[model samples]
Target: MSSQLLPRLAQEDESTDALSGPQTVTRQARPLRFITCGSVDDGKSTLIGRLLWDTKAVKEDQAATLRRDSTGQHNELGLPDFARLLDGLQAEREQGITIDVAYRYFATDRRSFIVADTPGHVQYTRNMATGASTADLAVLLVDARAGILEQTRRHATIAALMGIRQFVLAVNKIDLAHYDEAGFQAIAREFREIALSLGVRQITAIPVSALKGENIVLRGDDVMPWYSGPTLVETLEKATQRTGQSTGFRLPVQRVSRPGEGFRGYQGTVAGGSIKPGDSVVVLPSGVEANVKAIVTYDLVRNAAVSGDAITLVLDRPVDISRGDMIAAIDQRPQTGRAFTARLVALSPDGIVPGKRYWLKAGSRRQRVMVRPVSALDLATGNWDDAAVLALNGIGVVELDFEEDAIFDAYETNRETGAFILIDPDTLNTVAGGMIDSRRSRSGRFDALPDADRASITLPARLIEAFLKTEFARAHVGEIRVTRGEKE
Candidate 1:
């Protein structure tokens, strides 16, 4: 959670010495990181197992265990208990539901993949969010019979909020629907409406039967000849990898190394932008400046290091730098302030309380901060409503007041430096995950608002007209007085 692969590394330069033969450099396609999430019994595990099984990512020994565990239980097609390959918990097998997030790594001729199979139950929504936080795309599964349910909407909304641009709609169990093309189209149409409401546009809907392995890695059978679209694996192989919010160079110092004689270096994974020797950098929070003298990795000098590289930087001058301090491009520094507003996902059972002090950790930096709920989202209306507390699995904006200077970029600008976690002092549990929105001044505006005047701010005609186009706005229909700043 401290570091993320935020950007793609540039191709390594091929160098040839005059005394040596030619050298060639080659690299495989970037691996895709995605998550599978939807309602329970939606066949997420089965789908992933089938993917791995068909790809031959599963070893013979593991497949043997699956066969033993599934001894007398085979589907009509004689497929093994594919879901058991992912549901490792005994309780999960007993209840036939996934409770924890399971991750699997696999590869094909085209590309490699890292997929997280997240729980679908409403209670484990936090688990789903955790899996989605770093995902480049989301594969939301649904039963052909059930269509789009509330839980489906919730997962889709969270994935979009977490900045996932690509979505794959796997309409599982098409066999149960008798491979009805009409039913498949109906579900895909409804899901598109929901996705559009959440501002997500890139979506691929495929009718599949995970249990039977149809349209997963192989083409559909004659029954579902109407589904001539690409298989799930084919879609994933061609899907794009995520390149997170771009920003100026940032390196949150994890350690300062003075390993040997006459050598000192700052160690950390580069979070944003690229760095090279001779570039001037600033040690944040202290304003001390230094010039990069070398970029070190595995004792070999690198010509340049970009985001996601784990390298040690040797500077021209010694500065008062330490753990938790950030080193950034001197010309494009991150924001430094004590107060900021952010959107947070409450992850604990106790939820987030107003006026509570929690340890806010962003990258290598951790500080005590007071959190106050400013306003929460009204899921029913998609409106920002005044809220005093943020409940479990709730996603809303809150105000963060740091005891000391807090350095971050707006989440829209740099995901690596802008994301943070809230830890409870008593239990040391991660209570919430947050993304920096925009900094706020040291103002009493939040605490000063009263219930009677909550929605008292008026808007211009153009603004009101803009609000009328939202999905929530249509549900209310002819019911508001914009001049008076109230809603019915």
Candidate 2:
């Protein structure tokens, strides 16, 4: 991709009277974006369909389509694609499953929502990861009878690992479990421990049967009398906690719009904190700073916009900028690096291991890289050890070397630009999605050590840190070589 074709930011402040136009400002709170994730056959689709149906989010025509598709021939089971109300894919209906993230927009009196119903099978783990990465909250579903399964823990762990703070454990199929209080409590207990261990801060456990509509939209008289919490709908409706923002402002110009009169517009979503007209901003990957002259949207060139608004920014100087480049406050700059090391889960059918080259897509940025799975920590022991390959449902850490500078924040910091997915070149299949924790040495000093030698080595922290730093610096300066270094 040519650097010139990327988006650019402008600098000026002459549009104070631009708001005098006809369009009225309907300023409202930004919608929250979230995702639903769980294993297959866990009633994920039913829960969402119920939510839309109960909330009247779906139109009559769409509901008719759902009904027609759900009526199978000869009264056989009709597996309609409930999620297709958003994306309407033929393959989704035929497979009766979600292959990709299907986004749906809905609003209540309280707040607006952009919900991504992600796939929930072992094979589509990457899709689930992608969905959960950007979500402020995760709605994790599970069968009441089949409580705390491996895949259940896996999904919960992924949600926590992705830095999602709020979790709603929708314990579906409670009717099948006879709405047993003991059963529900047992599952909730186990989930609470796992969630806490995985760093999940807030968890709300609800016992409801998605199929029977018990405790979903309304209270069920037949459900356990001891449980007195609000229904799923009510709980969600009452949730008013908004997500926090970055202390600094950063907006990556996705595209530039020129609306004539020699006015160049920088169009993109505000990815970081609030930005105002007088705020001094820097165009990154170029290291140029310019004061913000105007923030325009439709007929208004306003003073500021909170994060999540897709507004056009007009700066004080027309410097060279592009799509992959980021715009941020002059004093608060994001960290930059060419080589990165991250934890990745194998979403490929063949699994992820050493010498696997693929294309990585992070937000609007794409890069070619290779995933070398060095170690897999035993979940039971919490000890890292070498693995031949990380198969489906396996979690491991890998070293990634990008062909270009892939700008990103740590997953702990920002989920928007920090998460990415690997795509197979041959099939163009999204194989794995990952969150960058902390960058390791691209030289793979620790990864290259033999399994036997790694266990025995216990070098000083300073020596190990210096050696690793120098090794990676050399690799970044010249040829990409990750050969094993000196021992002892």
Candidate 3:
């Protein structure tokens, strides 16, 4: 694969007319990215291993090693342990549990797939979120013997919050349930209710036996004739890719490139909308306006570029531009403020500390911010509870106070520009992944002032004198004015 900064196109569009010329051919759909998650011992690894085995993704040498590893163990059908194919680590092999996220790739005649096998242990929930963050769909496994567990609900909630709209409830180990159709139905119905509560409408529940190779890549007509639905592979091949953002143009400048003294260009991927030559653009924060002179790419000079295309942008006039400054359409600009509210998943062991200063990185910008937790999400009951701090694997709402003006959009509107991550300054480790909820003004009085009269507004002498005595005023105060009414 090319190591380009361009985003991958979800799908290609093709059209043809009989009178015009020869028929146009449709391009192959991009590989579908999906994740398999549930509670520990839920057979997640087995399901993925079976899928790879049946699809001929495993080589002969790998199969021989699996047989050797399972010399003393075999399923009822005389098949070697399927989990061995994925549990590559020595610790994982000995414990028979996944500790880290394992990614595997396979393909069918119609389409291709990239699947992530995530850990189910409660402590590894953060690892699961890391896998699901980029997945377009999720495959949630449930043991037929044990219907729905707390971890099952937790994974579902996190997947939905990460913007995965498509779900597949795999009721695995069906053979252990005597292939009872009622048991499968009950589990499927319960999961559907949970999915519905999360505003997820697209879901498909299927009965599967990963150990016996039933209803994975092939139908289990011999065992359960009642299931007339498609196999797991079929559902995946027919699923659709997640749609991109429909918002206006946004390009967060990554770097400034000057190959020669007279040439200057801004380099970054188009995060949203399309851009073309002569289009009016604005440099945010500074509010400098300019027109596009040209669009430059490694391949050729293009007239237009859409979302996901990485290209260099040349402006018609010289203006101050640098990394982290956004180049956006003049008419539709993102929110700019000093404070904002957000929802984040706490990933570090120390969790998110209240009133602690950390580095908040969004797009290409990184700035100092203080985080305060307001509420914690109860994944089991789908309710928010009062919280002062977020623990490991905890999800909560927080208030972020920034030292400088920040730009963003609501995550529900455009994920590319609305998502951010918090880094611990001391350790330089990522502590949380957050989504922008809304913007909040730092100075309420300043925002309430009329735009036309802001220049004439003045502070009271008493208030100014008292403020100047404080440490915050000494560090942040730039200008002070005293207002006095005319003496009568």
Q: What TM-score goes with each of the models?
A: 0.83, 0.73, 0.84
RMSD per candidate (Å) reads 11.9, 11.5, 8.5
| Total clashes for model 3 | 0
Model 2 CA RMSD to the hidden true structure, in angstroms: 11.5
What is the Å distance of residue 462 in model 3 from its true position?
3.8
Q: What is the TM-score ranking, best to worst? A: 3, 1, 2
Best by TM-score: 3
- Model 2 misplaced regions, further than 4 Å: 1-33, 57-114, 240-242, 255-266, 296-300, 311-318, 353-358, 368-370, 377-389, 402-406, 424-429, 439-488
Candidate 1 Cα RMSD after full superposition onto the native fold (Å): 11.9
The collision pairs in model 1 are none
Query: Candidate 2 has what TM-score?
Result: 0.73
The CA lDDT of each predicted structure is: 0.83, 0.69, 0.84
**How well is each residue in 247-292 modelled by candidate 1, as lDDT tens digits?**
7789999999998879999999999999999999999999999999
Higher lDDT: candidate 1 or 2?
1
